[model samples]
Target: MAAAATSTSTTQLSAPYRRSSTLQNSNYNKNNNSNKVPSNGVNGDRQVMVSKRGCNGVDNGGGFCWKASFMYWTLEDVAHVARHHWILCLFAVGLLFFMAVEYTLRMVPASSPPFDLGFVATRCLHRLLESWPELNTLLAALNTVFVGMQTTYIVWAWLIEGRPRATISALFMFTCRGILGYSTQLPLPQGFLGSGADFPVGNVSFFLFFSGHVAGSVIASLDMRRMQRWEMAWLFDVLNVFQAIRLLGTRGHYTIDLAVGFGAGYLFDSLAGKYEESKRRTSLLLHKEASLT
Candidate 1:
């Protein structure tokens, strides 16, 4: 009975020891868990996101940190933070220039001396007018497609790429060409398209110095090529040639006008490319400086 009582007393003493050890072990585990960092995926997300995210002004030496808040911003918000005001300004200026050119076109005298080359080409092409119905339909279709492509390029460059130089260059060239077209005050050819169906805007007698269609096509083609849209570029290039021929056949533009238009398009495209390159370099330099400091 004495041995049995001693064994019970030992068992009671060991139970307290076990409880104390269990408490110590739980405390140790809590400390270990507290020291350990969470492995949730925020670090990986940071590596994938743009450094500009959550940046209010230019980044001033803060290493890339992805913020969920910045990632959720809309395109307009991003563009605003990027300071894309020049795009809006260029568009506004282009609109003003268009209005000015249209006014000049309206004011120019209807009777102007026609270039001999244009006269000769128009006379010859006019003789081939076998079917007005077919010719008109074809011309209308081409015009519609050309206008659509030009509009798409303008929107893509400005809205998607946040670049307005292409649109600006096109607008500036178009205005300048229009001024030149009206300055000559070229006389309308005898077989000139007169009806509203033939000339969507008005008489083709005024803006005949260079084929706007050809110039626009060349600009759109070059811009498309620059944008890395190879198929679109080639399509516009083909359309350019086709439009040139159509202008000649319809007596809408003289040969000299077409030649000048082609040259102008190339020249302006080069200018726009240079402008865009400079802007890109500047942006890169600024971004680098911002990152370093």
Candidate 2:
């Protein structure tokens, strides 16, 4: 009986010690977990991404990054850009000068290269006219197409006069101008297309009209009427640049052709606006001069 009681006591004592060991294990686990928690809270995400997502620079440079915002430019490039468009306006002035001096240089025969696309086209057109039996009808048709005032009227009435007139006008005007621009050819020397006709009324020159559209579009973008006077001067230079870009394309026109085309467009546009003002000024000046005399 005594041995049985002793055994019971031993079992009770061992149960308490086992419980104490379990409690110590739990405390150890909690303490370890608390130590594992990062104070910064960013280590996990930083280790995975921060190293890879480095800013574009050497480590020593403190991530000083820059991008190329400026396009390439040079003095030669600037000069070329300037010259590229200036040729067009200058060409127009030169043409006018040449025309004015025609009487003085009447005796001197104008010379040009024998073969060119302009001449080729002119010759083809000439042959087609001379051989074709029903040529008069074609001539009349061509004339109607070439006539600027008639086209402008049609454009105004059918294209411009209706709903949202600005939209239609802008579209139709550009198209008409571009199309008519390639049709016209200069009346120069002989080779393929000999001197049968010079600036023939029946033939159309489209190059000129194209300038009108190009220059007109540019003018629309730079509506200087509301802007300052100095800003208005830039409009001319801007239009000239557009002309140069057109010429650089090089598929449609020769140097001279581009020059002339741009000049014509610019001049036509300028005159469209300033002609009345110019006349008024001229009249005023004439009256003032007369009074002074």
Global lDDT scores for all candidate models = 0.65, 0.43
Best by TM-score: 1
Question: For every model shown, what is its TM-score relative to the native structure?
Answer: 0.51, 0.24
Clash list (residue pairs), candidate 1: 61-293, 112-185
Quality of model 2 by C-alpha lDDT: 0.43
Q: How far off is model 1, as Cα RMSD? A: 26.1
**Global lDDT of model 1:** 0.65
lDDT of 2 at 202: 31
lDDT of 2 by residue, 77-134 (tens): 3454445457665888899999888867635345634334443434555456446635
Which ranges in model 2 have alpha carbons more than 4 Å from their true place?
1-100, 103-169, 182-209, 221-224, 227-236, 242-293
RMSD to native, candidate 2: 28.4
Model 1 stretches with alpha carbons more than 4 Å out: 1-125, 194-199, 202-206, 278-293
